[model samples]
Target: MQTITLDALIPREDFNILSSTGSSSNTRNKQTLSIEDLKYDSFFFSALRKPIFQRETNEWDAEKVCSMIESFVNDELVPAIILWRNQGGYIFVIDGAHRLSSLGAWINDDYGDGPISISFYGNYISDEQRKAAEKTRQLVNQKIGSFKEIEAISRNRISTENDLKNDIAKNLGALAIQLQWVDGNAAKAEDSFLKINQSATKISEAELELIKNREHSYAIAARAIVRAGKGYKYWSAYSITEQEHIVELSKKIHQLMFGIGNINMDDINSLPIGGPLNSSLTLDVVTQTVRICNGLDRKTKTNVGDANEVITYLRNTLRILQYINSKEKFSLGVHPFVYFYSGIGKHKIGSYYGFLMFAKELIEKKKIDNFIQVRSRFESVIYQYNFLVQQIIRKDRQSKRAYVSIKDYYVLLMEIILENPTYSNEAIVEEIKKNDKFKYLQTEIVDNETVAVKSNFSRGKKQQIKMETFVESLPRCPICGGYICSNSVSVDHIQRKQDGGTNAVENGQITHLYCNTTYKN
Candidate 1:
């Protein structure tokens, strides 16, 4: 689904400060907000806030958001937005956040790249986000026209050349989004929200866990790292020093995992942990990284009473990430394409987590050097037989279980490589088949179903052909002889700089960061 991200449309605020048992004294809260009331500078818009625990407001795609706006402009039967006004005079959305956000986005002309989003994300938006915003803006403008243009036409300040625009403008005055307000305390409001959302859209288990533990260390760290420490500061309550520390750690981890530019089939050499930096995918990646690094489970809710604990968790996660890709002495500088991506350029989360587990085991056993010794041959085998990684992950299905088997597979592969550095692919496969643990690695041959052939290749086939050609032409690191990518490559001096190495072409060679910094030395 082509989902449009309107998460920045409705800002989040902690409603816990409001009295849990108190209700709004004023009974005159409006039951509707007109387009003018939702303008960027309007008091009604400023007072509107999403509850901190609310899931991101990016569920609706471009078509859905535009459809909602079209319905509203036509005075169609749109659902009422549910809200709860606190005693402190702030209105928290109880339900229908997506609906309000869609209208707010259209009025403010900010699908995501607008002023609100820039301010909300601290000017650190991703390319993916920017592209999605542009797409939504174009779709909305093409279909329903901009809100300002429609209003101008409605007021007769501009010529209404377009019939559809004129009709929508004529109905603009009668457009009022009906509002249903919760009349109880914050607790009651929250309960209503959970019930309504659970029944209506059904929040995913992962998202529900995040919402329930929004204040916990893992959740906070995940949110910070996913946005590269730029979006809403869930850790804002912490001391300035601690907040700075959290941001520093979160930024390092984010860069390590997702700093590489967006990955596509054309540029499959370098892949990030969760593919791109989308809100949903990155949340899963960060959440799993935090849990795995800290030895926490899915159900463990470790609350962050202070910023210190959040910083600690972030630092731990950062250490693991650094070890995975940094230039540190023990860092593996593991290439994502070699380990995580399949031969067909698809990212396998099962392979990613499995490699992480394997790395952690190496760290625990102080055997990183053992892996480093055979790193070249190991990476070669992995790159050449990438299909095996795909097959193993495909058979396992469950990511968690697949990761365990993958980790064991890595161990088994390393063992074989250590014993015989020049093992052939067939020899390795035969050996693996002998082991009952990896009996699933048995080769399966299925005859292709006969069908009418077409002149043009299917999309998947074209991608596979392209990937095969690209893989064949990939460059190798001179130091460890492993495949190097634009993101992971580092230039090193062939001759030691201290030994009269000059800035000449002959003095330089391409290598992985770890190899260039530590292995060569």
Candidate 2:
């Protein structure tokens, strides 16, 4: 659906405000507010806060946001915003968060890249997010005049030839949005929020779990890693020492998984997690990674533990990521391009989890050396017949289903290759078919039938061509003979430095971290 983010337009506040003093006896507040009330400096605007449990206000696209603004400006029958005044006198939006946030975004000109978002996210915004913000800004400015321009025109401080804009400016002050209030305690308001939001857009199970258990260790750790410990501090309630520990560990893991910039068609040399960073998906991945690393079942709902548990989860997750692709001594430096990406350059989430499971097994069983001995040949087989990965993922689109099969596939493939390192691609395929579980996987055969060709290539085809070229040109690690990229590169001394290896170029060789540090010695 290509949603645009307006999450930062409204700040999130905890709904646990019943304990605070100065409770508002009145159930309802104001009935309506004019466009002026939405201005950044307006008192009414300053009091508006979204509940912490509310989903991010990013479901609307640029067109939808702009349309809402246009409808408001045209005085259409927009729905009333439902709100609750907490005991602390803070006005919480029980419903219509996106609606109010969209209006505030227009008035403040902060679709997401504005000062509010930068400050809220602690200036860790990604290029993808910035680009989306710029696009929303451009679209809004083009379709409807900017709020500033319209305001200036209303005050006769500027002139424009467009008659429609002048009319909008003239009527802007008189536009007032209807407001509805929710009565009762914090629990009631929260209930109302869940009911309204669930009935409307329908929250995903993952998101609902996160919202319900926002303070859980897994949720805290996931949020920390997803935003690289820069966005809203979900763990702020922890002690300073614990918070610092959480940030340090989360940042390290974040760098390990997403240190490489956003993946694009032009650059196929290396990838961190095999795809662009998506907020929801990345959050889910981080949550899953934490659970799996901690030996927690995927379907189990864990309790909201203390900060120590959260830190432990983060540390365990970090260890797994380092083992996957890092410069650590014990790291296998598993190449993402080989294991996580599909034959046609698509990032396979199933393959990613499969590798995680495989890596965890190797670490647990102390079979890293065994795998390393057959790694080069194993990768060659996987690369030669990468279509199997595509078929497995396509067959089982769900990650849980695909991950187990892919992990088993890796284990079986490695067993066959270790049994006979000299096996050809066809020989390996024949051997793999012996396992009834993988019998459905077959090598692709070309039709060779003449068909009409398009003058232009599809984006996927272009990306595939680029990926092929990039893979063909990649440098192999001298020690492990596996592909190496910027993320996993380490320089080794042919003559051990302890044995008096000099700084001369002849003494140096490029190798994977594990190869140089552990395997070679």
Q: TM-scores for all candidates?
A: 0.90, 0.90
After the best TM-score superposition of candidate 1, give how far the Cα of residue 121 lies from its true spot, in angstroms: 1.4
Candidate 2 lDDT, tens digit per residue, 438-481? 88886876756469676688776677787878888877878767
**Top lDDT hit:** 2
Assess the local accuracy of residue 65 in candidate 1 as a C-alpha lDDT between 0 and 100.
Answer: 90
* Superposition error at 280 for model 1 (Å): 2.8
Question: What is the per-residue lDDT of model 1 for residues 333-438, given as tens digits with 9 covering 90 to 100?
Answer: 6767667776666667777777777887887897776787777788877776666776787778754467778889889888887887777766776687778887
lDDT of each: 0.78, 0.79
Candidate 2 residue-pair clash tally: 0
The alpha-carbon lDDT assigned to residue 31 of candidate 1 equals 83
